[model samples]
Target: MNMDTKSLLIDTSTILFQQKGYKSVGLNEILKACNVTKGALYHHFPNGKEELLITCLHSLNEVIITDIEAIFSRHLSTKEATISMIDTLIHQFEKDGTITGYTFSSIVSEMATMSEPVRNACGALYENIQNIYCKKLQADGFSNESATSIALFMTASIEGAMMLCLTQKSADPLKTIASLLPNLLNSLQ
Candidate 1:
């Protein structure tokens, strides 16, 4: 496949993976969406859906990991950096009304159990997030355990807020969650 086809495949696959999930989404569907033949797909991704998905997951990892690192560079301290990262995540959910299925976390929960590679991919994302927050917490003089717990809470709260926002058809849950985060952070201290 050519560069343009590869790009289209990735883009279509990302959206499809977001909406239908990795298992449920079909290769033919992606091909039809991109108006490309199966041969074309295999030309670019010989391993089929799994290969394309790994590529997509890598894309997500690149985007978010870079974003987190950039955020870290800007904040005054680790604590502030972690908080900023949380805020940025919240803003994304709020902007989209916390719609389900598009997030990497949601995708991981659906996929990580079934596929070893996907599981490792999911684990990598979690590890990166945990490390980022943990570093910040340590920098802010927080105990390692407390920081880990807060990171857990932060993940749960964000996913819960997304679910609620999708259910309620508004970003209100996210808005409320955003307001609640500082208090939760304080509680960690």
Candidate 2:
């Protein structure tokens, strides 16, 4: 029950934070969303909102890392794996019909300046994602230096395309990136 309550709070808080910025979301809102009391929240997060935010960021990162790993594990080549990942993301957005955007972008944009821990957590997650891509590229036989550079570019490009897709209310940007990624990655070999 204790672990369930904590997970509930974290999951509820993540959705709220992703939909609404960190500054705009209140502890009361999170509490109400999860239907958990202050005592339970405080019991799990002794440091309060900042601590909760950090925990939420970590949770979100773990989910993304797991998804990326699964994609690589299932696919034979980095290019195929990356395209499959993008297809999954596009399918998700199309099904939801609303682009809630990435949690890392929302948190880093809103809270990074004021919270060092939040900033570090977001930064670490970003690096971990890039490393995943780098490892996949290396496995595909790219040189270390080239793989790292392409990984950085791929990560940044996908994030940027997501933002564009959200803003434009269309998945064209992502589709364009997805279509171009195979050629772009293949060019490096």
Candidate 3:
């Protein structure tokens, strides 16, 4: 299997998976999109569709983790950095006039029960996000319990809000959610 062929398969699948939910996308569609034959596909991914999908998930997860690390690197306190990251997302969603519908949520929800490897990969992504949030909050001076709760709330809240925004095709939800976080923090104090 040519290395370019494998990368091409993963790249094509990523776009399709992101635009359309994983379940909605078919392997033939990906192969056609990549202009690759069955032999090449199987050569690059012997485990077949599941293996390929897992690779795609891993690629996406790595990009997000790297982005999160960059976000985490630039602040004296966790609150500032966390808020900034949230704000960035909010701004992006607002620019589009809706939460762009995160692919992670869609992928995890689609494959969670059916595929062990897919579920595990998604779980790792969630854990990484949680760890980043929890660590930041803890460092920012919140008690572990409070930090954990806040982090979890923010995670769920943001994703939920994004889904709503995407469904509604409006960014109001995201912007409002971002604006409200400060109030939430205040209430916690």
Model 2 CA deviation exceeding 4 Å by range: 1-3, 99-103, 112-114
- The candidates, ranked best first by lDDT, are 2, 3, 1
What's the lDDT of the predicted structure labeled candidate 2? Answer: 0.84
Over 1-189, each residue of candidate 3 has an lDDT whose tens digit, in order, gives: 455998999988877877777888888898889888999999999998889889988888888888877888888666667678777777777675543223377554565466788888877877777788888878877889998888788778777877777778776676677778877876775
Error of 2 at 189 (Å): 1.6
- For each candidate in turn, the TM-score is 0.78, 0.92, 0.87
Instruction: Name the candidate, 2 or 3, with the larger lDDT value.
Output: 2
Best-first order by TM-score = 2, 3, 1
Pairs of colliding residues, candidate 3: 97-171
Measured with C-alpha atoms, the lDDT of residue 27 in candidate 1 is 88
> Cα deviation of 165 in candidate 2 (Å)?
0.8
RMSD in Å for model 1: 3.3
For residues 46-125, could you state the per-residue lDDT of candidate 1 as single tens digits?
A: 99888888888877777677777789878866556655665665666567644433247545446645578777776676
The alpha-carbon RMSD values of the candidates against the true structure, listed in the order shown, are 3.3, 1.9, 2.7
